[model samples]
Target: MSVEAKNLTFSYEKETVLRDLSIRVPEGEITVFIGANGCGKSTLLRTMARLIQPEKGAVLLSGKSISELKTKEIAKQLSILPQGPTAPEGLTVEQLVKQGRYPHQSWLKQWSPEDETMVENAMEAAAVTSFRNTPVDDLSGGQRQRAWIAMTLAQGADTLLLDEPTTYLDMAHQIDVLDLLHELNEQEGSTIVMVLHDINLACRYADHLVAMQGKSVFAQGRPEDIVTNDMVKQVFHMNCHIAADPIFDTPMVIPYGKGRKPYGAIAAAEAE
Candidate 1:
């Protein structure tokens, strides 16, 4: 299954955030959206997830307009994790994860063995099984983020949309979360779309990169092909050197700014 945004135009009040944007999300791959702040990356993700309605055009899920589908039906096929999600004060990790099964449940089937299995598997996948009984409020930031991701995984949707899933996370925790998502994509063949602020991480992790600028896609392709020093300068308004990551062998962006000195230069100066 694939998700496509066709000629999408979205606005807040009188100001337009995204205009005439069109892109197709490749199925069974990790796609990352990158841009500077307020470039409408998050807004575009939200629009595709149906969290926000578009002022013009439509989001199509497998050739069908998402607006035409029932809410529960859409939930069964697509799951979304918005930025900075908050749970109720006293909700436990298990309780929150169990909520993901709501779309598959009805009056005739409130709870079932299938629901229990899904929740258990989801917690295991997210590495939050040990904290199942703990209240979400009691968990650390990383733990809580994993708990939330477990809930999204429990939904068993083919397409997953995330907005800044690594916001406020330490470097290690950010990698942990992203590694979990990468595992899910590889194991389950799920389509993953996320808005990310860290361009280097995006380039390292994304199978397909969508770089937005001026409220539209500036470029879209494999990170190796799309990420360039000129593209970085144009999109981010900052000078950067585009190099290959020694580890991932993908495009790496080294930004330039005051007080930012290259390690090799510093070492050379010290030697002199």
Candidate 2:
């Protein structure tokens, strides 16, 4: 489940999004990628998942080139849930999740006991079992998102790559999804690589942090090692107060020095 990227580079037209970026994702842990809006985090993730082929360098899964593996073989070993997976209207959750079993199925070897077990387990892992019969379009945003994750889980892959998994979610639902992914990593020993926009949340949940600057890796290590206030200012171009979460005991970031009120604003509020 370990992933290594060596000299990984990707380009769009004449522009290079990733430049000689390389990092190792440890097996059976959550590795979070954090960067500014156009800093190539998504590009790197797509390349790592083999969704978009890199113009230069290689993404190796367990030291084997991803391109060398058969499509099905690669799928069985790693599954990716790209940002905002779109499903057809009227597709039920069960029907959608069942699609993840495709790698294990063939025209001949279709729908075995193992397939059934995997689908069931995926639903349970994503906590979408109750809504299995609901149409995907009818489900709430978070529920629909979970259904997509269920599909990826049903692939029965050891490594799961998610691009901005918490996109378009409210804070409550964001934590909910993170909690589910945390459970997956702990219980199933799945190696997870994800792009996360929230630095605080990423630091809290990620076992390892990969910070990116434009077209290159800025820094990567345990969250505590790399998520200092100075690092935040350097990577994000903003000032922040860094602290430890009282509840989760993880790095907490509080952005500051934006839109400061006039003098006596605080006392004026109490006087009113």
Candidate 3:
């Protein structure tokens, strides 16, 4: 599925969060949005999800305007996993995953084997199958996050949007979740778009990278094409050395201090 935003603008009360923003997420690929805080990343994401309407432009799903599609119909075409999800007290993992089937069901078409199989597959894919009977509130942060992702997966949508999906996860769990997301994109050909805080991680995982600065797209391309030191300095206002990662050969950043070097190197050299 393809998501295209054309001249989108969003405002809350009197403040504008996104202004004249336009982006086209590659179809059937993982695209990561990276930007400084309050740079309108989440706002743009919500607008694309149809959670918030744009005042100026439209977000198109496939070829149709998302607003023109019925809410349930849109849910079937795309699903979003917000930054944080709250489950009702005592809700089981199975119950939470089953909720994803709501858009696919009606009074006349209650539960079916298809729904059961989808839920089971989602749980297994997220590695949350063992926690199916466990209450959502009882799971750890990572496990709970996985359960939420599983629910989104069960929606069976062609496109998935996630906001800060790695938040609250330790380093290991962060990679774990990202790896799972990559696997989903590879295997199911789902269009995955997300906002990520870690630029290096985004480069490592994203098939396409979109960098935003001051409510506009600073750059968009493959990681190697967009993640240069100049882009980092322009967007983040920090000096950094960009190098190729030994592992993935992606761009890696090494930050420098303000007019200083490690261990007072200048002072030590003067003494010598």
lDDT of each: 0.92, 0.89, 0.90
TM-score of each: 0.94, 0.93, 0.94
Clashing pairs in 2: none
lDDT of 1: 0.92
For 4-84, candidate 1 gives per-residue lDDT tens digits of: 999999999888999999999999999999998999999999899888999999999999999999999899999999999
Give the per-residue lDDT digits (tens) of candidate 2, residues 26-133: 888999999889899999888887888998899998889998888999999989999888889889999999999998888889899988898999998899999899
Lowest summed lDDT across 10 adjacent residues in model 3 is found at 261-270
Clashes of each: 0, 0, 0
Candidate 2 residues lying further than 4 Å off, grouped into runs, are 258-272
Candidate 2, number of clashes:
0
Cα RMSD (Å) between model 3 and the true structure?
3.3
**Model 3 per-residue lDDT tens digits across residues 1-272:** 67899999888888888889989999989999998898899999999999999999999988789989999999998899998889999999999999999999998999999999999999999999998999999998889889999999999999999999999899998998899999999988889999999999998999999999988789999999888768998888776777788999998877674575434553464346
